[model samples]
Target: MSKYDIALERIDAAHKDDPTTITINTTTLPYELHYAQQMTLYLERLDPNASELLRLAIRAQHLRRWEIPRSSYPATKIGYHSWRGALQREQAALVEKICVESGYTEAEAARIGALVRKADLRKGDPDTQTLEDVACLVFLDDQFDKFEKDLGDEDKIVDILRKTWGKMSEAGRSEALKIKLSERGECVGTEGFGWLSVK
Candidate 1:
């Protein structure tokens, strides 16, 4: 197999260790593995010509995420940000190691690491921005319903969604409009993004 295939296999093997399980239709998968798949799926839809490095970065976006549970941190907003930042760094380092072990040069591994960490997102790095877009798309497509139900506060959910909306590029937002949302999800999206007119 190719180096890309080797690295991807290694990444998925690591993802398989996640204890959290999610059943989609008749197939069951580790939550992180499923999330990684979703990230790749959205990345392909968003950028079909995405580079190999970008593909590897997207595949390992949440590499071994369960290692750091949210409860390990405080419950406040600062805590939430801290937890997320920690996850990004941890995943980036882990993926970088995998890249190197699978025969990638240090520079290539570092580029994958940067994409995993979403470095330079605010500075308008195209690949980093696309990674962010795929993440938002995955959340909206796969996790939004469950998340909304758990939160159970319409106003708060809309507030959170507005923040999510602000993160996406125009292309991401446009693709988001195509996702099949539940009634509640649609309502929340409409409220959060007044321009979202997804029929």
Candidate 2:
């Protein structure tokens, strides 16, 4: 959503270490290959709750390409658009599939899917409280290890969730428990992006 360097520098100063915010952050690392690594670090550092969701949404917004400026890309515009659509479907499908598996009504699943998509867009909007907002950031050093890694044992998710939640704000902690509960005592599958892990 940002085009200028000044705006990005401001965001970078705020969330450079928290890479999930890297997407909306118009900084030096915006186009870096290690962007995923930073993103994973940010997510792993935060629990999958409102605060984390807020960060995810910000990253998603950056990932969502409204249009690829012709100057920046001479060709492959159509292909890029198609690729973006594929990713969008993949994101929506994950929510829909999870909702259905959780026994959500058809209408409910649809609503949640829509909500999830909208949430992503919200992060890109300038008027909103960004992922860099103090509300979403709670510093707990070495707190990232609690969350399950893609290659980690799934059983570790439970302990990770517990430890991760412990590092969050009260509201974030509450939502973290809710997500784990929704998993039905199970763990989120470590597939695809796998919490945006770098390796």
Candidate 3:
């Protein structure tokens, strides 16, 4: 079974009737912001109001739970847990930015950030809830709102990966790359989101 399959199973067992799917709501967030584009697409199909932060947290939770590495998990959840402490630090700075931008006290912004992190870091919510999970979940949900309506035939599943294959979580993207290379005899040329093209 694939790495995604393991996470999927865990997610399924954890959120069986809890509605793990996210919905698309571009009014709140956008597709480009979601790091995991495809998974974001998946969530948006489920719920429009899905919070990106919550998604990130859950994914992080999953990673901690399964002990899956960045290379194995989908691109969205890669390095997710490792960046948690950094994300918290950045949010502290963001709180200051928000304070300056909104004319609020730095303390107030800090409080808000604290609440967000507290709520986001639900210990029992998932096995490895993370900030990246929240980011991707929210990002994907936002993107799905705009893109899902355009989806066509189910018979043809075409994944145009915009992220580096190496970063994909649960080896999703790498698995895809290997399959495509072996089946199509092509090699991907570059890195990041922009350089991908079937050869």
Candidate 4:
């Protein structure tokens, strides 16, 4: 197998042991593994010409995420942010290790690590931006319906959509516009996220 395939295999193996399962289309998969697959699909749709490093980073974005439950952190905004930051570091380290073991050079591994950690998001790094775009698209497409149901507040839902919209690139926003929201989410998308509509 190629180095990229080998690295992906290692990442999938780690996810296979997640111990948390989600059923999709009658097929059960470890939640993080399913999530990784979604990220890769969105990355391919968003930028088919993405580099090998970016591809690796996207595939391992949430590697073994179930290992670090949000409940382990304090129940506060600060704690939530802290937990997310730490998870980013942990995922980056794991992906970097896998990349090196799969024949990537140290520099390439570090680049993938940075992308996993989302370094320089506001600095306009193309790979990091693309990763962020793919993430936003995944959330909008796959998670928004469940998330909206849980929140039960239209204003909060729109706020979340607006925040998510702000993080995406024009291309990402265009993709987001195509998502078929539930009735409540559709209202917010039409009223608040309408600005994202392509001409």
Instruction: Report every candidate's CA lDDT.
Output: 0.91, 0.38, 0.36, 0.88
Per-residue alpha-carbon lDDT of model 2 for 1-199, expressed as tens digits?
3222332333333333433323344554433223423443445445344432344333433232323332343357686666655655654555455445545556655544444355343445321223322222321222233333443665565444444443444443432332322232232422321322211
Task: State model 2's lDDT.
Answer: 0.38
**Candidate 4 residue lDDT tens string, 1-199:** 9999999999999988888899988999988888889999998888999999999999999888888889999999999999999999999999999999999999999999999999979899988999999999889888888898898887887888888888989899877777776776676677765753442
**Any residue pairs clashing in model 2, and if so which?**
none
Give, for candidate 4, the lowest lDDT window spanning 10 residues: 190-199
Which is the winner by TM-score between candidate 2 and candidate 4? 4
lDDT of 4 at 71: 97
Ranking by TM-score: 1, 4, 2, 3
Model 2 compared with the native: what TM-score? 0.27
Runs in model 4 deviating more than 4 A are 192-199
lDDT of 4: 0.88
User: Could you tell me how far off, in angstroms, the CA of residue 33 lies in candidate 4 after the best superposition?
Assistant: 1.1
True-structure RMSD, every candidate: 1.2, 19.4, 16.4, 1.6
The deviation in Å at residue 36 for candidate 3 is 14
Of 1 and 2, the candidate ahead on lDDT is 1
